[model samples]
Target chain A: MPAITFIHPDGKSDRVETSDGESAMQAATRHGLDGILAECGGNAMCATCHVYVDASWLARLPAMADDEDALLDGAAAERQPASRLSCQIVITPDLDGLVLKMPERQV
Target chain B: MSVSGSPVTGGPSAIPHLDVDPFAMNFFADPYPTHEVLREAGPVVYLDKWNVYGVARYAEVHAVLNDPATFCSSRGVGLSDFKKEKPWRPPSLILEADPPAHTRTRAVLSKVLSPTVMKQVRDRFTAAAEERVDLLLEKRSFDAIADLAEAYPLSIFPDALGLKPEGREHLIPYASVVFNAFGPPNQLRQEAIERSAPHQAYVAEQCQRQNLAPGGFGACIHARVDEGEITATEAPLLVRSLLSAGLDTTVDGIGAAVYCLARFPDQWQRLRGDLSLARNAFEEAVRFESPVQTFFRTTTRDVELSGATIGEGEKVLMFLAAANRDPRRWDKPDSYDITRRTSGHVGFGSGIHMCVGQLVARLEGEVMLTALAKRVARIEITGEPKRRFNNTLRGLDSLPVTITPA
Candidate 1:
């Protein structure tokens, strides 16, 4: 099992143990963490699950897909360079200490 | 003005044109064949009867929905362009508006129907669903559409809005008219409008602040007026948006779920084994039988999509139901498999103007399905389910089912 840390905009952090193969969005949803809307239920269509990857761990993750890139442009929060849809990120053991920052809103 | 250039590269006359009137009675009765014809014809087929362009493929439909700026919803999501034609009613403050206006109204709704507020109503809805299912189980056999589907949502949602209970029956007819009006002014639309007049009047009266009970969604919208978030006049229309869009879609969704479960008993048994699959089951049902089938989006500019260039202001019908079943998108697209990850299906639509009431609809489906899974062992259809025809909605007029208790 790998541990994932979700950091909110207000400096609070919740760390949870996540399994490989499930999405980061699923992990947050399963743990009932705040700030991850995932309104489309990990569909990669709704940009509600927008999260900014910690710069230290950004290079370790996969590249954003074209559909995701388009959706991020419509995100309610400002799209930072590290902004990604949490639903598109699959967990792996190698990414054990992945950190994600939740956007303020996901309209 | 005759449009020039053909997507096929032969000539302007080479564009795939069909004589299908999408809103016609025969077409509405069984749309899948027509849907396949449209999808196979080309990416953008000209519907000569209605003089509109239509797209039925998954990729193109998804693209048009996502690119709201290029393929706009502001002119109207229906066949009638608001700018050039008179809308059957005033345009929806949320659905029929684009950014800046859409942005502001959507923000208010997102906050009002936020997950926190939805969670608050969950337990009450779950309890009511259980009670309703228990009563139906006593009968052992009943019309799932009228008894379980319609009865269940009508039991919980209206009260949640704090609407007066006396004339809640009118809600379905009102919703029917609203959805049908999305099509051309055909016989179906005309009849639905005439039938829904009293219900529409009742709904209008209820949108007023004095008519809405305090601490409900309707009152909450009115409170936004006091906060200067929206004007006093705009508050009621926002409330009207909720009343119009809320109930019937969920009812049809629940009906579709019950229809699927009965038809696929193995899937029902799978659900019986694990009640948590209820949410996925409902979503799969939505994908399997899309309730709201089609909506038209007007091109803001001359936009090229999937090799077809649509001229500015031309109405492009996005066949959401067809898109859900497109072979390009799903493997075994016609099958009803509850375990399938129906994530990207355009059942509730996509992008900015997606169903604002979907979270609430999901909660209703989850609670009701979970309740049925707990008490029912086998669900079997007893008689042929009668189909209900509407220009945009696909649903049953009646579904007779007999459920064996677990």
Candidate 2:
């Protein structure tokens, strides 16, 4: 199992264990991390499970899909350079220690 | 937990059984009490009245929806299973479908109703909402349900769909019949079907690609058929899906929000104070009083949920409204608070089959409430609020309310 670290707005971090092929959103929700809402159940519809990928990991993350890029424009908080929908980031052994910065608000 | 009757010796596991008629008019009027009963019964309880299994707890309902392969929707989302009985109408390509089939149709609709498309239509919808709200506020007293809830959607949704204005009045009746037909063949369903003939015919004709004006959702859907993404036959049915779901659900959703704000003055003031809360307010109202209450999913295979074994082909009624207010899932679940995070609630259901047009529905509710919040200082109920009963939807039919200028 690979471990993923989620950095919350308050500077708190929770490292969650993830199984192969599950999404970062799924790992966060399953671990009771409240920041990721996943309102549409990872369908990329609600844009609630938004995150700012760590700068170091941004280059390694999968390319953003067209719909996710479009929906990100409607996210509740301000979009940043490394902003991405957490649900779009799939967990794999290559990304053993993926880092995500939780946004301040996800409506 | 007490087991009803005797333990089953056959395939399905023995679960607590209750004879609660979910479609009863009285129960529909005030279902919280029954919801409490079902939630208390267990995670999975058998409804002897409807001869179906039910998942009232939020965790189970969420899991069931997230895993559509097991609790499938292709077999009709209503109580009547499509495999056992023929659907009253051609099945919805997106709503009553599973993967692959559901995948293709959903992509077309997903692209059509995507947030990008909603953002494009936002300005017009917001303008229309303001115009309608301003006009009704002049009266100072009106039926919120009919005047605003029904009026706003009827005004803008058709234009968005690109239907001609003449026979547009039939959309509600057509939607009523379509949603009502989701439940059993009760008197409500029968009566709605009786009165909806003309509306249905009109809607059926309008769903055709030629009848719709170009450059609208209907035409956009048809264009996909031309691109070979969707079949020509599935195109009209997809448009029909929008016609069936888009209007009435939003009507009830906006109605529920107005009713909640009127009934709970504090919440209304909260929205008025910070107009940004309009979106969250609508989402809260949806959670507190879910407009689309329940949907049935047929078990694709024998499955064990919350320690109860449901056999293959058994119907499991997922209590969306009950799950919305489940005490285990929400704190002060009964309260209508606008400031809470409500996006995760199942008011719109969850998973891939979740309300495909939710962003559109949210835009309608958000703008309507924002317009009202900006202009109206207080909302007072001048007459009794009446519930508009439908087999699957819960909303107000008439709410006599007087608004004070902000």
Candidate 3:
């Protein structure tokens, strides 16, 4: 199991563990955490699951898929260099202690 | 995603052969009991009535929608295989096509229907919603389906679509005919089609470039043609796609929301307490009602599920409404709770062919719910709500309700 940390815009940190292959968005939603609406499920179709990954783990992640990148452009909050759709980031052993910050609103 | 692996071998140990006629009027009236039976029956049950395979469980329905390569839509998202039968009308370039074709058409639509476009129209949508809610709150009691659900969408959505004001009344019936056409050829489908002749012609006329107003979605699609991405011929088809796929569903969805709130007053109180819950409230309504009930996905190759296998070229009827309420995936699945996270529900269908115009639907729903929340305290049912029967959709014909102002 990989535990993920979600840092809200207010700087409060919450953590949850998810099984391998589940998404960060799913983990947040499963635990009933706030800030990821994920209106389109995990299809990378809606950017409501927007998150900013810690800079350290940037190199560890796979290149963003085109659809995710396209949708991130329409995120309710401003997109940043570390921006990613939490739903597109599947949980794996390598990403075990993943740290993410949520946008203020998901729309 | 085409099947190139070893041939699918064994079938399920036991497959329940169902005797239910899914398209029957009674089934549409109260599908919950039958839906539960289907989900519990098997992952893939054999429907002897249509000689088709039925997938009602969440896992199977969701998986099938996502894996379009295996459960292809190009063969027609209906009972009749396009490969063998002649379509009464042209198959939708966006709805009924596979990748490459679906890819191109969807791209243009995606950009046109994105939340970015909604940004430009947010105030307009909100203003219209507020104006209507003001009138309705004054009425105290009225048919929510006709006054709010149908009327609101009829007012705003057509302006967004760039449709002419004269024949806007035809939009709903035209969409009804389009959705009804997806069911097995029956008396309902025949009558809907027969009664929709003027609607059909009105929709056809509206699809043309000259008939559309500039700066709206229809002209915006034609703008793609000007950029040389799609041909002039394909432009009207795409505009037609927006008109066909867009109108009726929102009315169904909004009606579903109001209907749910009226029946589930506790949930309405929550929304009244917090207007921010508008979008999720509407989303939950859609999941609770499951208006766009079912669509048939034809298998491109042999597909196996939990304990069943469907052969290639066979029609797999996806009971999306059943999947929405499947106990395996949802907690207290039958209940309507506004706060519940309904992200994974197949309300808009899923995958590349998911409802491209969903953002607009959400916007329309969110604003209306918000307006109601701010002013209305209680939605009391005044009379027996009537069901608007259709082969594919589950929605209301009339919801006579009295609103107590907040």
Candidate 4:
């Protein structure tokens, strides 16, 4: 299993192995990570799973879909060019070591 | 903010036997205590100030909303006495009309906004939720209402209905005033009117056929007209229902859920431990703190409730949030425990007018909560929670939380 590390808001980090085809959210949820909430179940309907894409890995991921971009406008945190809805970003072996900064709130 | 010291003899403090105002301050900010008074006073209390009939108990309130024939909506659902008040615009064709006519219009809407059609849009919905959550987890300190609550619904609902991006910010305030206007005219109503001005034209323009997405709900309303179910003119009002009914209700509903979870950490742990509890949490939150607090229905003829006479054309206000917390119906009425079976509570208005957009709300909740439960080991409050200042919705204005990973 490819390993993914999630850094918490408190400067703590936890590592979870990801299934090759699972999105970062699915991987976190499957492993019981506390930082990601895939509300709308990865449907791009609710912005509960907003994440700041790591700058270095930003170009490696696919472009944000129109609906995803529109939803980013409503996220709890400010939108950044690196901002990508985790549900839209799938984790592959090509995307190993992907790091995402979680926002403070997704209420 | 406290009315406790006011005079009780026929003054504003007195809970009038009958014909109280729906838009009154007592009823708007915190109607739960007044609901209890009404249920105790009689099944029907005439609010002398607003001249509207008040039904505080669960059974009577449910009966009024369920029975459209006796308690008609054709005259309009608001206290405006449509004949007297010049509505900023016509009433919601779906919310303001009675059955047979309402049935026909709802049928047209039911056909277009059907579950079968909504299923196709599920992926988009989930993706939107996933992205917002991911981003929020990064910043870690946000006003849940302004950032997530209002933003999420506004982002997804308009696009789902194919609304134009230009001047779409006014949709929530516009719908808020529309829902508020259902009560009597007061400071809240006046505030709503002033707040609603700039957004009125944008909302009206969105209703036009040319502005709608080719196959969106807006387009579907026009299609219903082509099918002869309704006149071309009724399409905008029907689409307006989607815009009005779909937005704040969900945000508030979801906000209530977040508030409950934060208020009760144990329940939050249970949900994370068992992903299946996500759906239960949503229903429990609605029962605990209903979003749409009270909606009125007018009686067509005299009827007795709790030995009180309810005359025809009288307004019956259903206290959904109160009934959800009614001691007569619930055990430990105020507790926010998700483990308890909490389905019967009428958070979504009951009967024919029971919220049609409920599934959408639930789906949004389940997706987000389940995902959150997966990542965070514990969700604890970082600061005091705040509530939104809306008369109809009982929701958190801010929920400061700290998500700790397992």
Using Cα atoms, each model's DockQ against the true complex is: 0.12, 0.41, 0.57, 0.02
Evaluated at residue B250, the lDDT of candidate 2 is 95
Candidate 2: CAPRI quality band: acceptable
- The CAPRI classification for model 4 reads as incorrect
TM-score of each: 0.83, 0.90, 0.95, 0.73
Clashing pairs in 2: none
The Cα error of candidate 3 at residue B53, in Å, is 0.4
TM-score of candidate 4 against the unseen true structure = 0.73
Model 3, residue B67: what's the lDDT? 90
User: Which of the predicted structures, 3 or 4, would earn the higher DockQ when compared with the native?
Assistant: 3
lDDT of 3 by residue, A1-107 (tens): 88989998999999899976899999999888878888988766668999999999987988898777888888899989999999989989999898999999999
lDDT tens digits, residue span B255-370, model 2: 99999999999999889899988987988888998999999999999999988988999999999999999999898998999987575699899988989899899889999999
Instruction: Please identify which of the two predictions, 2 or 3, would achieve the higher TM-score against the true structure.
Output: 3
lDDT string for model 4 (B1-406, tens) is 2222122364333434544444465555566666566666655566666677766666677667667788777666667666556765667777777767777877776656544555566678778877777776776666666767677777687887888888787787777887777666767777888778677778878988999998887898888888888998888878878877788888888888877887788898789779877866987888888888787777778876655666776766677777777777678978988866564468877666767666578777777677667766766678877655564666666777766655
lDDT of 2 at A77: 84
Stretches of candidate 2 above 4 Å error? Answer: A1-41, A62-70, A73-81, A90-97, A101-107, B1-13
**TM-score of the second chain in each model?**
0.96, 0.96, 0.96, 0.90
Regions of candidate 4 where Cα sits further than 4 Å from its true position: A1-107, B1-31
* Candidate 3 ranges with C-alpha deviation above 4 Å: B1-12
